[model samples]
Target: MEIYETQEENAWIFRIDGRLDSNTAPELETTVFRAIENGARRMVIDFEALAYISSAGLRVILKTAKDLKRLDGKLVLCAMQDYVREVFEISGFDTFLPIAPTAGDALRQVAPPKE
Candidate 1:
């Protein structure tokens, strides 16, 4: 999977392309953990380009969510395909994790309000 990351005012946005499975989950885990270690708080994962996700991928998201929660941070996920959304729903992650219909909505969840 390809991870494209950009920093907003108070959030780190990661646009994921390709599949997130056992092999690719590790790379994403590393990137996310590294960012958190470096003091990144809010984060958004854009799944617009992602075609598939495995249990390992869910684990990574769960772990990241927990980590961010401990730091009093937040994580938003957006632009998910129907099948992908079903995966998250079946996994019960949709209960706690914020899922937006669009990247703009996701950004709004983490972005500061305009004056």
Candidate 2:
């Protein structure tokens, strides 16, 4: 999977493309960890170009969300296709995480207050 990082005001956006599976989960995990290290608390994982996700990918996202939540940060997902969305639902992630229909919506939902 390819991860594109960008700054939207105070939030960080990660636009992922391709399949995030066992072979690529570690990459994604590391990328997210680096973002956290760089002081990014509000994150949006944009799945507009992502085709598939395995359990390993889910684990990475789950870990990130938990860690962020502990710090009073937020994590949101956007633009998921049907297969990916189904996997999340079947895995019970839907109940644990908040997903938005578009990247803009996700970003807005979790955007930090303006100074």
Best-matching candidate per lDDT: 2
Q: Give the alpha carbon lDDT tens digit for every residue of 1-115 in model 2.
A: 7899999985899999999999999999999998899899999999999999989999999999999999899999999999999999999999989999999899898897778
- lDDT minimum window of 10 residues, candidate 1: 106-115
TM-score computed on alpha carbons, candidate 2: 0.96
Give the least accurate 10-residue stretch of model 2, judged by summed lDDT.
Answer: 106-115
lDDT of 2: 0.94
lDDT of 2 at 83: 99
| Model 1: lDDT to the true structure | 0.93
lDDT of each: 0.93, 0.94
TM-score of each model, in listed order? 0.94, 0.96
Number of colliding residue pairs in each model: 0, 0
